[model samples]
Target: MKARNKRLILVGSGVALLVAAVALVLSAFQQNLVFFHTPSEVAAGKAPTGKTFRIGGMVEEGSIAREADGLTVRFAITDTAKIIPVTYRGTLPDLFKEGKGAVVQGRLEGGVFRATEVLAKHDENYMPPEAAHAVEQAQKAAQTVSQ
Candidate 1:
């Protein structure tokens, strides 16, 4: 091949490889991406079903129930406007408590959230941004309805 043709081929091959790399990176990113939702959104069917996602809210007061197995527990998460039932079969964080900010990662199954992981607020003054926003919105909505 002529020198000019060789240069064009090299450039074309490099572009193709780069495009392939970019596509792979994008695909991986999409697969790993997880979305955060609130109890209201999940109840309204805004959250995707059968896919891994996260829900953030307060662990409703007096909703925690532990089974005889001791490892399995069920509770309800609430945003003041809505509630979602969650079941987890593992050790909970020390900070996990009813009426406190909590986030659970799991899939919605048969009207319940089967949590694979749970996260709790680190301090009294700290809550996840998504949970805080959800709680704020719920309070505003409640006020609007009472007026």
Candidate 2:
């Protein structure tokens, strides 16, 4: 085989391998990706039905109910206009509290969210930007609907 022809074949093979590697990495990343949605989005049926995802909003007041088991707790997450019921069966973050902002990652089950992980704000007035934006948008939508 000619030397130039051999070099061309090697370069093409290297490019093909690089492309395959990048595709593999992207597919793996996509499988692990979890999207974030607000309570209003979940209530509107916009969230994935059974896939793992994240929901962020304010924990509703007077809606927290701890089960007999020390680790099980149910509460409502609200984005000002809508609420989603969430159940967590693990130790909650110390910052987790009603009327505070929280982000929970989990899947939806029978209209309720089963949270596998919970993230609460680090301090007072430190709401996550996405949660705050969602709440503001929900409130605006509610006002528009009322008018």
Best by lDDT: 1
Residue-level lDDT tens digits of model 2 in 1-147: 999999999999999999999999999999999999999889889999879999999999998899998999999999999989999999999999999999999999999999999999999999889999999999998999999
Q: What is the C-alpha lDDT of each candidate?
A: 0.97, 0.95
Which run of 10 residues does model 1 get worst, by summed lDDT? Answer: 121-130
- For residues 70-102, what per-residue lDDT tens digits would candidate 1 score against the true structure? 999999999999999999999999999999999
Candidate 2 at residue 16, lDDT?
100
Determine the backbone clash count of candidate 1.
0
List TM-score per model, in order. 0.93, 0.89
RMSD of 2: 1.7
Per-residue lDDT of 45 in model 1: 95
Q: Give the TM-score of candidate 1.
A: 0.93
